[model samples]
Structures are given as structure tokens and as C-alpha cells.
Target: MPRFAANLSMMYTEHDFLDRFAAAAKDGFQAVEYLFPYDHPAAEIRKRLDDNGLTQALFNAPPGDWGAGERGIAALPGRETEFRTEFAKALEYAAVLGNDRVHVMAGIVPADADHARCRSIYLENLAYASASAASHGITVLIEPINTRDMPGYFLNRQDEGQTICRQVGAANLKVQFDCYHCQIVEGDIAKKLERDFAGIGHIQIAGVPERHEPDIGELNYPYLFDVIDRLGYTGWIGCEYRPRGGTSEGLGWIKPWLKR
Candidate 1:
């Protein structure tokens, strides 16, 4: 059976960030993931997870001046020092949060920026991240965000992410396969999963067009769940989506899976 983790970042907006841990556990989620834990102390976040019996499945490294519209700095030149500093902080939190996966976002670049230069910087940053994280038994992840939602984002395809992982050549480095992004950029979801399963570190899902509950989207999640099972993917499937109504009210779609 495919295990699902509630994405506290997007789901359970009805409660405070810390309080969302219990909300997700109450909803039968055994694990939880969020965008960034820097706002709260790692000890506080760990306490919430321990209190709710929930595992911290995944989270992103600091994405450099989010308020300034910078999504990430891993791909940006002259930001290597900043990226390493922020990524080390992420690993420190992961040590306390007990999560094995840390996603390093590829920052947006200028339309006229040199693509080759960006790729070189990205690969170097990823190599550093993977090597540093491996010492602590942690895996670093790279995700391909859809251009429609995140224009100018450096990475935009599964193959591109996988190829980067190969170039980085670290056992602990892998791709974060997000179904929502894949459906938008490439329609052959199942085949892609099968083809790229070897390099996938984690998986995420949401409605294709609206980024809502998985069941609310065009993709048949139930069928895809079966496909994931057949593919032998033993990783958490992050419920990274917004609720159309109350978060819990829209959780009926996951009840059956939770029971299993």
C-alpha cells in the first residue's frame, strides 16, 4: 500500500502551524511535511511530531529571500556560500526532526541568463549538498516545478532532474517526482513513474488543473496508487494540495487509503 503524508504547509490551514500536527494525526496521517521549519525552532517542531506520533517526511532547504521573490539559490551563481549555509541549517533541523529527505529548490533565473552557467552552478551546489548530507545519512532531493506556476524556475522536467542526479552521482541524491508538475509538463504520468522510479527519492501529488485534493483532479489517484504499488515505490506520497473547503472536510478521499 502507498503511504500518504499530510503536507502541513498547504493542508490544515484551519489551524496554526504547530497545531496542524495534531490535526493531521487526527485525520489518520502517520507522517507530515512542510515547506520550511526555520520559523519555528527544531525542538518545538520535534515536540509536536513526538506528541502526535507523526513522522517528518520531507521539507525544503531555505530558498533565499523568499520575500524578495527568490524561490531558491541552488541554481543561482554567486550564491554558493548562502546556499551552503542555509542547507547546513536544513540538515541540522533534519537531525532533530528525524527526516531523511531534504529538498533543495532550483531558484528562478533571468530570461536572458546563461543556461549553461546556471547548470554548472546547480550541479556544483547539488554535489556539495549531497556529500554533506550523506555523512548524516540524509538524502538531498531536487524537484522540477512547473513553469506555469513558477515561471523562470530552473528545473522543469523529470528527465532533467534525473539527469542532474546522475551527474551529481551521489547515492543519497535523487529527484522529487511531483505528479501535479509532471501532468502539466508531461502527460504520461504512469510511464514516467516506471521509467524514473530508480532515481526517485520521494513523490508528491495534487489535482492537476487546480492543485486541490488528488481525487478532485483529472488524474485517477486510485489507479495511480495501484501503479505506484506495482512499481514497488516504498516512499511517502505527500498530499501537497489546497482544500476547496475545510481541510478535514475534503479528506474523505483519503479515508479509504488511510484505512489500508
Candidate 2:
């Protein structure tokens, strides 16, 4: 079975962020990931990880001013300096947490911005972030988020993400394949997994339409899990979903997988 990581940012929300580490462990998760960890001190987060015997699987670099509707700055024109600064800060947290992967949000595109300009900026920022992350032995992940959830998200397709990864040409740069987004943006989840497994660095999953637990999704996670195992993907699969009910109560889908 593929190793699973509870997304502390989405899962275990009943508890405080600092307490989610232990909550995940108590609920039988061996590892955890989150959207961002900058809100807490590195030492505090590390202490929770140590206390709970959990591994930090992944987390995203800061997306600029999240409250102000800026999902990220990587692809934004003239924000290269801010993007790089956030990446360096993420690295500091990773060093303390011993996490090896960081997702680089590509930011929302401006209505008046040229697509070519946005793509160029995105690629340039990826190259810079990937090269810098490689020095710390960390991999940079670019995910294809569905535009439905994030209306203006710049990176919203697997092919686009693959192209960006290729242009960056950094060994540490890879795709963060979110099954939920892929299913919405493009179907053929199993085929995509098999075809692009080589380029993928991390994976995330949630139910279709509602973005809830995988058990009720349009995709059959059991067969897909078997497919992933057969395809030899040894990386962590992040459970990035909102619980339909209480987080712990909704973990029935994961119990069987964890038993494997």
C-alpha cells in the first residue's frame, strides 16, 4: 500500500494547528502535510512531530498575502524577489522539520497580464526555487489545482505543470499530482498516474465535486490504490480533503488502506 500523509491543513481541523500533529498520530497516520507552517515556530512544530512520532511529508511555500486573495507570487510579474524570499523562508522551516518536499504555488494570473509573460515568470521562478531548494536536498513540487476551487489559479493542468517542470530543468523540481483536481480538469486518473509517474514527486487526493473523503468520490480509490501500488509509486500520498463530518469519524476509508 502507498504511504499516506494526513493534510494537517485540511484534515484534523477540530484541533489547533499545533495539536493536529498528535491528532494525526493518534488517528493512525504516520506522516502529515499542511498548506503552510510559517504561522508557528519551527521548534514548536518540530516538538509536536517528535512527540507524536510523525514524519513531515510535505508543505507549501508561502503564497503571498493569502488573506488578500494572493494565492502565490511565483507567476506574478515583478514579484520575483518576494517569491524567492518566501522560498528561502520555507527552506528554513524544512531544515528544522526535516521535510524533503515543498509545493511552490504558481499564483493567480492577473486579468490584464499576458499569458506569455506569466508563463515566463513562472518558469523563471521555478528554476530559481528548484535550484535553491536542491542545495538543501529538498524537492520543489508544482501542483495543478482545478480552477473551480481556485478561479484564477495559474497552474491548472497536468500538461502545463509538466511543461513547466521540463523548462525549469532542475533535478529537484517535480509535479504534485492532485487527483481531485486532475479528475475535474482532466479525467483518466489511472492512465495519467502510469504515464506521468516518472515526473511526479508527490500526490494528493479528495472526493470529486465536494472535495470530501475519498470513499464517496467519483473515482474508485481502492482500484486506484492498487494501480498505484502496481505502478511502483513509493512516495507519500497526501489526504487533502475536508471531512464530511468529524475528521476522525470520517477516516473509515483510510482504515482499510492503513491496514495494508
Candidate 3:
């Protein structure tokens, strides 16, 4: 059976961000991941994790000005300096927090921008991050977010992500396979997982169309879990979903999964 990690950013919205660590542990999660952690001090977060006996599985690097609609700066034309600075900051946090994986968002592609130029910048930036993160024993991750939720997003396909990983030629870089976005962009969930299992570092799941709990999704998570085990994936499967009701109340699916 796969070890599961709660996505505190979306899973435990009922409590304050700092308190979610305890909430997740009380609810039976052994690990946790979130979108960003720049707001609070890393030491504080680390203490919470230690207090709860929870491991920090993953978290995203700083995406520029999230409130202003800038998802990430990595693929942006002239923001290479900012992108590297943000990644270094995240690496600092990860070192103190003992987090090993960090996702680097590829930013949105401008409608009128040159595609080749953007791809070039993205690859170089990833290579830089991969080298820097490797020195600290941290791995860099790239995810293919669906365009529906994030229109114009630079990376939007699994194959493209895999290709980028290969082209970057960094052993520390891998794909963050999000099932919700994968189903939206390409429907073959099991086959895709099987094909890319070697390059995949992390996995996230949610209901199709609604982005809710896995138990209420169009995807058959139970069968997919079987596939994950049969394929020999040993990483954490992140529960990156909004609960249909109270976060704890909708976790009936987890108990049965743990028993396996």
C-alpha cells in the first residue's frame, strides 16, 4: 500500500495553517504537503511537524506575486534572476524543515510570446535549480497543471514534462504527476502512471470536474491504488483535494486504505 500525505493547503482549510499539522496527524496522516510556506517561519513549521510526528513530504517553491496572477517566474522571459532567488529561498526553507522535494512552477505562457524562447528559459532555469537543490540533498519537481484552472500555464502535458526532465539531464529533477490535471488533459490515468512511473516523484489526486475528494471522483482511485502498488511506486500519494464536507468527516476512504 502507498503511504498517503495530506495536502494541508486544500485539505484542512477549517483550521489555521499552523494548526493543520496537528489536525492532519490526529486524522491519521503520517506526512504533509502544501502549496507554499513563505508566510510563516520555517522553524515554527518544523516544530509543529515534530510535535505531531509528521513528515514534510513536499511543498512548492515561491511563485511570484500569487495575488497578482503570477503563478511562477521560472518560464517568464526576463525573470531568470527572480526565479533563481526564489528557488534559493525555498531551498533554505527545505534545508531547515528537512523537506526533500520542491515543485518549480513553469509560469503562464503569454498568448503572443515566442514559444521556443520560453521553453529555452524554462529548461535553463530548471537545470540551475536542479544543480543548486542537489547540493543540499533536495530534488526539484515540475508539474503539468491543467489550463482550465490555470489558463496559459506553460507546462500542461505529461509527455512534455517527461521530455523536459530528460532534456534538462538532471537526476534530481522529476515530474509531479497530478491526477486531476492529467485526467483533464489526458484521460489514460493508469497507463500514464505505468509509463511514467520511473520519472514520477510525487502523485496528487482529486475528483474530476469538481476537484473534490477521491471517493467522489470520476477516477477509480481504488483500482489506481492497486496499479500504483503493482508498479512499485514508493513515494507519497498526496491528497490534494477539497473536502466535500468537513475535512475530517469526509476521510472515510482513508481508513480502509490504511488497513491494506
lDDT of 3 by residue, 108-145 (tens): 88899998999999999999999999999988999999
Q: What is the C-alpha RMSD of each candidate to the true structure, in Å?
A: 0.6, 0.8, 0.7
Whole-structure CA lDDT of model 3: 0.94
At residue 248, candidate 2 shows an lDDT of 96
Please identify model 1 stretches exceeding 4 Å from their true place: none
Candidate 3 wrong stretches, greater than 4 Å: none
User: Candidate 1 lDDT, tens digit per residue, 224-250?
Assistant: 999999999899999999999999999
Residue ranges of candidate 2 with Cα displaced over 4 Å:
none
- On TM-score, the stronger of 1 and 2 is 1
TM-score of each: 0.99, 0.98, 0.99
**Distance from true location, Cα of 4 in model 1, Å:** 0.7
Give the least accurate 10-residue stretch of model 2, judged by summed lDDT.
Answer: 106-115
By lDDT, the best candidate is: 1
What pairs collide in candidate 3? none
Which residue pairs come into collision in candidate 1?
none
TM-score of structure candidate 1: 0.99
